[model samples]
Target: MVGQLQIEVLGELNVRRDGQLLPLPQSKKTRALLGYLAVVGRPQRREHLCKLFWEVPDDPRASLRWSLYKIRQITNTHDVDRLTADHHSVLLIPQAIDLDFTNVASLRPGDLDTLDVEVLESLAAAFRGEFLEGLRLPRCPTFEAWRLYHRDLVLRSRIEILRRLVSRLWEYPERARFYAHAIESLRGDAASIDLRSEAPDASVSGSSRDVARGNASATANRAGQPGSELADASAEPKAGPTVGTPQARSQAIRFCRASDRVRVAYALCGRGPAIVRAAHWMSHLQYDWESPVWRHWIDALSEEMMLIRYDERGNGLSDWDVADFSFAAMVTDLESVVDAAGLERFTLLGVSQSCAVSVAYAVRHPERLSGLILYGGFVQGWRKRSPHDVATHEAMTTLIREGWGNSNPVFRHLFTTMFIPGASQEQMGWFDELQRITVSPDNACRLHEAFGEMDVSDLLSQVAVPTLVLHARRDAAVPFGSGREFATGIPGARFVDLDSANHILLGNEPAFETFIREVGRFVAETVQR
Candidate 1:
């Protein structure tokens, strides 16, 4: 314990002697200074450190010297000079010093159990309050950016770890402690559906390759990965535990055009008027098949009705060899799935981007729709890319193209901010892993391209079905304006704006539950199903 010094400073700042916790002196500035320097985990300019800790100083340099002195007096370390100095550069010694920042930074996907106890202790300690609370540094943009960057990284990493644990324990109701803690970390409403009982036979397929490797012929039939070999192998039984009875067989209905093997995917549950629900990007029907989040929502709609959920063409169990993804292609896919499912008329629930598709479907075939529900929807097509936005998108695509594997952090942040706003580090990590496994940059780009050109405003007026448009006031991705626009376009479309910002119904339980309840009642009263 004495030979190797482990200093954990990320969320909360704590110094330990060996494996045992050591009391750090109680001073706000000192702790802030130490945490800031430690977060750099590298050398920093003395000027930067001083500007970060001290706000208004008559002599800022001298103020830095005084703060350094106080920090040294409390920590009893010569490294104070290394973390701060006037002339020379400041450095935090990497070797022989153990800290949670190091551990959390070192974490990768698929290695949760191997995380050392010291790292956990350090994370628990550093995460006390908001970063550098009660203090605002002078106009140093570099310091401000660095402070935010480090804080976000730590928060994101911690959340990623917890999210993985939450996913793994999802089916184990016995691990309620882990689930409860995970939910608390997520800031998600505790009233969300439970994964265990609702999705008893559901399984989570880790990745597309995992999904592909198990069934090469099937993957080849779906065009396989991004590029595939056409050599046909004999069809083997599908992967996973097989249900002996044909009634229990969960088969995907394929929607394909003549001379085109690429198919749209749909899953059917229950019997009666078909209800179609659109999931966001990065869906795995095999995995979601088991997710209580999906099951509960679907089950609610499926009662006295036939419910259909489909995987968009480029991902999930759907055929992936399409040259491009467009609203037209997506619409065709939807039509195909409906055709295969043999649904003549149905209700539609469009979530997130899929809301556009739902609108398109209703507009195109108003005669076939009994009712339409739009949740967290947007109306703008990404085709109107300003120069800046186009540049941003290109840069994003480049970054994603550069790396999209389990270790990629860019996709992690992108996925987190898009879907799980304020998600924990663990959750982000798990999603990053899952996202990588589901679709590739090529496929994602195709989908993005489709979203870009998607203009459903014209179709709104043509919608013949009784439509309900629901959105969250605080949705960060698509502003509430999009929802308003969607409702305004569709004749007599009812618009409901909720108080929450969770884009997906899975995260917003009470609101979603109420939404489904209302929709059920609406369908009962409005539709002749």
Candidate 2:
């Protein structure tokens, strides 16, 4: 007896029947054609498929015929009628096969709020990944256009479901945050979708919360099963179970006094080898885990290592009203946090001005560090780079002092754009709030001034730890040459140039993927030694 036919087009394209996987055609164009037909869910003209997938081929019609024959050969083994073709058109018989994409496409906005919790959970699980991930036909412009449009449509639908789930599970903050994380992972910022706007009278029943919790538990159980595609599902959501998983929960905030007697707030999360992030100019130990701009980093890094992040002496949950905001104090803060965290040796991660602080620490305590990873770092600060930078710094500091906490995001927008030019509107909004709440206007100016005057050029050559330097090619905050200069100063340091404009990597950018992959590899190699 033939079993049910199921087509999965979420993560990787696959066709299964009777609990058996079917081999697809070797040609990507053939696979693309099959996926498009299944997703389009209607009869397509034979000529249209030919033009879409083989537009650049010399013999488009002949190519299509060969592809169809190969597809038929594969499908005929399972069920010949799975794919139906006439002389002029072709279609995947809807009754013969079940398609995840079609099921997802059938969902409406109202279903998100009104549907049973179990039903909503099933719909959420259906979205394993972006539509047709890693399936690209270089020369097929028509196919590519259609794929993008369909992908966007699926993304919108997924976002709507997630938004409504979050609203409906309002009392269950853990589940709400889980969906929020999924929404952000899909590059659909949850903040952009106002839950209130979606369902004004949305209310969750006790049974609904139980259903959602059960769904989360089921997801966690599936996360451990062998051969599961959990990693590829949605940017490593399987790294942990729910948003309230141990790593996602609030870390215990501890205070350590610096040499200058200023209190520095720090927290350690996850479990593995210690990896310390240098306290940059802006940080909030409490809000950072939930913020859109930083949560991705927190989640991804904590999955493999015990990530230690902290607020500098004058920002976030640290002592904001401080007497000192100098480079010496910054280094002291790092030293105190390291000691407080009780790390004999750990990997050091630094970005922006904190790169200098990290470099200085590595130099002062070479035996204390196992590896160094710096992004968009510079040995010399803006004022010391050139006279031009001095004037620019002065102007920026002036603006921060004058319009730092204004209700209007105009002044803050300038900083946000330069830092993350590719940030979504939701990200921009979160960053603006972070800036205002992280530190006062006076502290902002002081921080920028301190960054401008920072000069660790002489300390670069003294670094003794294995180092990896990364910089965005078009980083607006730090010049690409400056990053190169930093690498050049350190003997045998490796340098990677990221193709991005954002100084701070955004979650959705291609550069972030490269960054994470490389960093993971580097950390693994370093620990092996």
Candidate 3:
């Protein structure tokens, strides 16, 4: 049996036996040594430990040994054992102690509301101050760097988890206010470190008390880095499980055979004709909801169908292998999501570049599909060789590769203009963050490469299902001509060209209403067949 122990280090460090507080060793250095190792929990050599605490005299080797002896004596734990050394190499075995940090790492997204609420509460209460109190050593640059690295990682993880919890606010409305406050508090003044001038003003203010208690839920959400509520709410949860698994609310999963495969990650709501949504490059099943773009999309779709969307294999919650963004691989990923959702026949809705996949699915599986809908999409590449296009693609790819967060303002403006058009200040921030969450530069380049090669003209002619193609007249990324061509190629395909521009429709009433009217007509008319 694995023995159990409790160690809390929020404001002050406290160690407990089974349920009672235990007396710690006298030496300050010794307590600090044990506390640091327990929190880090990774195997380390003796030389490394000595370097971390430079206060330990010049002879780090002897000082390391002395610290080890003291740690064992104070804790009465046999888990700390010395490894065989080569030259200055050293290692410590921390297999015995059950640290709270490890427990925090184990929380998953699918846990019941009760358990998830408790875990979040406990973790929020743990990270009280810096890792160690006041053990300063001018010579321990390595320690300082390591400490900062771990501290940031912990903070990032907490933010991500809390974000997921908030996204599933539908599941536990009661826990929302508490988690929101905790998330905002933990974030401190991170928003003050602005990376762009024109940032969003989204905030998170909905709690059970707010909803049930009649308080106002905040209006817009922004990207997290620049003090946006959308950013805080949409941050991706750190690693674990795929789609409804305990650790993750949504996961990108792959199910393949030979050359055919499908990658899909989904957030499910209701059950009926499943709306298989093909998303533009970046998406987190959970994070996207924080953005108004996704909110409007889901609100419209879920009224009639269960929405199934996933990041393309190289984007969002999927694997990060850049070379796997080929069309063939993407089709396979979609198949996996369909199979996972266990839907036999359903509607397929393609958005932005994903229209390519929806068209392919219709041509290949017309018999298995209930209907098809395309919105703000294109059949051909935007412009063959405009220098502006090339520069935009290259610049965005470079920014993603260099680092996607708080770094590139040009890329943000370009994408915001393309996706959300005249979005509110908060709305633009949400779009910027959603794009960032989509994929890295390497992956984005691969997606762009795949998109460049897609020519679905031959396949469009083969689609026989009831199809509705909706395109914005002023779509910056995809021209109206492509939507027209798509409708022309498919026999009996109905086309509706809206006066609005922005690719994803951005909550425009007239455009959205037009889309719903056309799509609803198609779905209702076709289902009778």
Top candidate when judged by TM-score against the true structure: 2
lDDT of 1 by residue, 94-147 (tens): 554566666665654345556554444344444554344443332443344344
RMSD of each: 15.6, 17.4, 17.4
lDDT of 1: 0.56
lDDT of 3 by residue, 189-232 (tens): 22211111111222334443332211123322322221121111
**Each model's TM-score, in the order given?**
0.51, 0.55, 0.53
- At residue 213, what lDDT does model 3 achieve? 17
lDDT for each candidate structure: 0.56, 0.72, 0.57
Return the lDDT, model 1, position 286: 47
Identify the superior model by TM-score, candidate 2 or candidate 3: 2
Q: Positional deviation of 312 in candidate 2, in angstroms?
A: 1.1
lDDT of 2 by residue, 1-529 (tens): 4667778887678888776889988788888887887776667777657656764437888898898888776555543577888788887777777788877766655456578767777788888786887686646644554565356446656766766677666788778768766765654322111111122233444434333232222221233222121111111112222122244443444445576657566666677888899988767765576667988888788878888888887787676778889899888888877775667788999988899999999999988888999988888888887888888889999999988876455788899988988998657766766786678899999888889888888888899899999999999988899899889999889999999999989888889989998888889888777
Q: What is the number of backbone collisions in each predicted candidate, taken in the order shown? A: 19, 0, 21
Mark the regions of model 1 whose C-alpha exceeds 4 Å error after superposition: 1-259, 292-295, 385-394, 422-430
Off by over 4 Å in 3: 1-263, 382-406
